[model samples]
Target: MSERRRRIGDGLAVLAGARPDVLAAAPGARQRFVALGGVLLSTGALAAVSAAFAVGMALGVWWPLAVLVGLGWGAVVVNLDRMLLVGMAHDSSLKRNLVMAVPRVGLALVLGVVVATPLTLQVFSKEIDTEIVAMQAEAADAHRVALESDSRFAGLPDLRERIATQEAVVASGGVADPGLAVVRAGVTEKQAAYDRAVTLQRELDAKAQCELDGTCGTGDAGTGEAYLQARAAADAQTAVVTAARAELDTAVAAVAAAEGRSAALAGSSLDADRAELTRLTAELDRQQAAFDVENEGSGGILLRLEALDRLGGRNMTLAAAQFMLSLLFMCVEVLPVLMKLLLNFSPPTAYDRLVQLRDSGDVELEEMAQESRRTVAQAKEELLVLAERERVDRQKEAILARRRAALAEVAARTEAARAQPEAPAAEEPAEAPRQLWDTGPIRELARSAAVRTVRSVRRRPADRTPTTV
Candidate 1:
């Protein structure tokens, strides 16, 4: 005899508020729960800190304790959850199970506090004096000390000796010291020397010209006027020479600028092409990373595509499976209703038309039951296939969406890079480059590793068989 009837009796015991377990609480189970609760709270906190530490390390920090704590925390917390679940199964009443599920939630909240507390502590504990500010202060102090150093004072004598030599040169020429005279005159003393030289040179030249050509009317000209004309001519010649020097400098600057531009134009397009390739490669990498997140069994692009096709075929069969499962769950939900209908629609006291139909010595009624059984069997087979297909498809779509989003992000970044300036040539100076132009070694290293992995994977002939471990 099937125990469906006995099972119903047990359900009634539960509903009637009778003791459902042998003990009010299982002693062994209770101790396990307490231990799990404590460990989860403690270890979970430590794990968060460890994970944060690991992230910092990856970013070039060297906090060893974080890695140790994170590994320990993760291991302890995982085992703690498992142990807690085992203890929870001791009494196994649906009502009690529901209440105990809440502990895990509480444990999670407490762990959050653990992670947050350390960060708060770090923020508060930061050094009051910054290294940059301290360094600047030290620099200023050093500069002041340099001004007062014996080394600085020693150099002053050499400077004074040069000044004395200049003074002697001025005195020998019967001229005042230009530097001192300028201060007294409230004008540059060099102007007086220039004026005298111009006047004298003109006077000499004018007299000599008249003597040479025999036509200059100023041969017997006064020395003062002759000096003035000579000075003007000399000033004009000096101005011409200065202008020529300035033009030469300007030409040199223009030539250097043009050479730089020409060299840059020749190399820029190659850098741009390299940058674009880098962006495309990055996008492909991101897509693959996203695909991995779903952790589906899809092994490659070709495998994923094939799985997608299989999913569609599986979906076509789902409609039939759904019909069967719907029927089965409905049967469970309304089993009481069915039992009531069978036992108490009040079996006819006298055989009525309906009773006559069911009792007709009826071979046809028996055949109808057999047909119903066949239908149920076919429905079940279809349902199983549908269930398996759906599971596969759902995993595939999740993986696909992740990969798609990753790919899109990579593409956007790469396309944006096109508008950005290319990294300068290796021969170029570092100060001249922008951040976007720096691809950073990490991106390159990851790419090379990926390439090597793919090449290794390709070297072996692929097995068409599904992976089994």
Candidate 2:
């Protein structure tokens, strides 16, 4: 059991290092760390790609660019997943581990959000659809108001009124201008005069035919006189009728010419122009009514976001449900990171404790070896300093000994010279009287002796070595 526990500890440590040896040395550890990491990365990648795809679809991006973006997002998420695990394994102490956990927790939260968004959107699809319909209607009404606000649109009613007035005039057989109405009146009077003239001509022709047929004629005079008189009266009446008919015909022609001009002007004029304006206005209204804002690409999701914000007062039950569902999904996404965090605080099982003890023993042994190496290195450095100090002291002692020997040799020479110089005094030269405390003569003698000794030493041969101390 102890051996097995030791093995588990070694495997865990190795896996934490993410070394290739994990495959050969600890297959179980390899599966636990490497395979699990792969699973996490795959899950994160799928979630990220799905999220990006949904956003692209909502925004109406081209399919190829959307796919490329999804792939990029997936790669980012995979890297984050790997980094999250690495960070989790980096610290052992509670405080330091918690500090390291911050970035991982934030990453997990973002992943959760990415994964949960689509689900939330799917769940609330019906509500979004209804909202879109209402928004479309509102947009249509707004468009209509905007179109009506235009100056040209505002003048449509006036155009319609003018059209109606013109229709009424046309129905009553009136021309476009008041002057054409006067011309029509003249035509009517000329028509009446022409009818009277035609009636007189018809009666004259019938009476003259009866008299010629001998049906009913008074024998007031011979046939010639009656005929002449009848003829003259008939001729005079015909002249009057001809003159009136000619005048009527001329009037009728004048009225016809005026009517023709009026009709021609009406065909090319006001009514046609008004009809065109009416047609154009109606077309504008139709276009305005058909306009729908909610149907625009990506507009639906924006509206959904609005609905979510307003859900609290609008639909409490649905809002609660959505919140709970999102939270549940988010927890699922963060479960692995949470597990790693909890593992840090958990007490080790018996086997794990045994493995930890084994690892601790090894660590202690390694620390002892390092301490021994440091001690040896420090002792070696101290020995080198001691050797250098001893060499300097030896050199200094040799120099002082040489100086002392030179002083002793000079004293010996001075003693010998004093013993051999007694016959050399210049007739006992008189000495100056000295004060009781004075030592002037003794100082003079010492100075002369020192100068003589220095000269003698300079004259000595280099081969004459001074005695050593």
Candidate 3:
């Protein structure tokens, strides 16, 4: 258990960018860094879960892929947080610390919002789902209304009404032809006349029988002139009734023929109108079906977010709860950076002091190394200059020695020539002075001096041998 605890502490220290060697020296700093690491780890874990939920809901990706994406996101978040923590070194100057921390805090705030939103959405998933359903219905209705208002389907309602009117006409057996209506009216009047005639005839026949039997009406016992007149009228009414019935049959046939003709004419137009109406209705239905398919199940992250917003607006309690929850999550995300900043503002901890000390020590060590290199380079340059001066001085002394020897040799040769007899002019020739000037010893000395000077110049300071006088 102690070993495991130590390992865990080491891991956390590494996570917080703390040096284990340094941390071991200062045990006081270990717990602080360990706590910071815990915050970082929790933040990363939350980020992963939030990212997974967001990816799954927003992109509708496969679960395994979403999990992979979540893991990657968590790693990135951990790296970012680690960078933030590591970059904020303990500083003595409050102003410098603030300057360094401001941008990091701002970045953390942005990250916090990004990480919190998805978790917040997940928290209110049920409410968001319900709101999303309502929103989808509203969107569908709006789209339907927009489609109906489109010019292509603008005449749809008129077509339906026109088709209905035409259908009614066709079903009613005929068009409203004036000639047919007149014929029907005439047939009706003739039938009425025939009915009246038949009734009169029956009454007349009854009255005649009653008079012959001497029952009532004329008070006569036998058939008289009145009875005979009534009988004749009865006979005339029977003829009228028969004629009326014949005319009624003819009119009925004419009306039937007219109805057939009218029905045929109207049926053709109704069929054309009905076909157009069906085509228009089918087109509208097709468009509506496509619209439905396009917008079906549109519960993406954006939609859910919008739903959450709407839910918040409709209920103050929910709004407050959502706000509080979001704030809580964001606070968690921002805690590490804020913690680092607060620690920076406070009196330096032993860990912070050690980190500062180690960092300063590293700086001092680098500076010392650079200065040493510069001093070495300067010494080397000075040594080369001194060696060059020595070589030049030696060459000058060798040249002087050669010059003195040549002068001495010329003086000796002149004195010897004077002591000896004057040589024959022909034997000496006119080139004697030139020969004296270009003597062997002097040339040898010049040659030796030249060789020695070349050797001396070519040799390094360490390799140089002393010149012979």
| Per-candidate local distance difference test | 0.45, 0.64, 0.82
- Model 1 over residues 278-312: C-alpha lDDT tens digits? 56446545554554443332223233223333443
Q: Which window of 10 residues has the lowest lDDT sum in candidate 3? A: 431-440
Lowest lDDT 10-residue stretch of candidate 1:
120-129
- Score every model by TM-score: 0.18, 0.46, 0.69
Model 2, clash count? 0
Model 1: per-residue Cα lDDT at residue 380? 82
lDDT by residue for model 3 (100-184), tens: 9989988888888999999999999999888887887888899878877899878888878766665665687764544477878
Residue 117's lDDT within candidate 1 is 35
Candidate 2: Cα lDDT at 317: 91
Model 2 ranges off by over 4 Å: 1-42, 45-49, 52-56, 59-72, 90-92, 173-269, 275-300, 307-313, 347-469
How many residue pairs clash in each candidate at the backbone level? Answer: 3, 0, 0
User: What is the per-residue lDDT of model 2 for residues 268-338, given as tens digits with 9 covering 90 to 100?
Assistant: 56667676786868788667635643344335456665656565458889889888988876776676677
| lDDT order of candidates, top first | 3, 2, 1
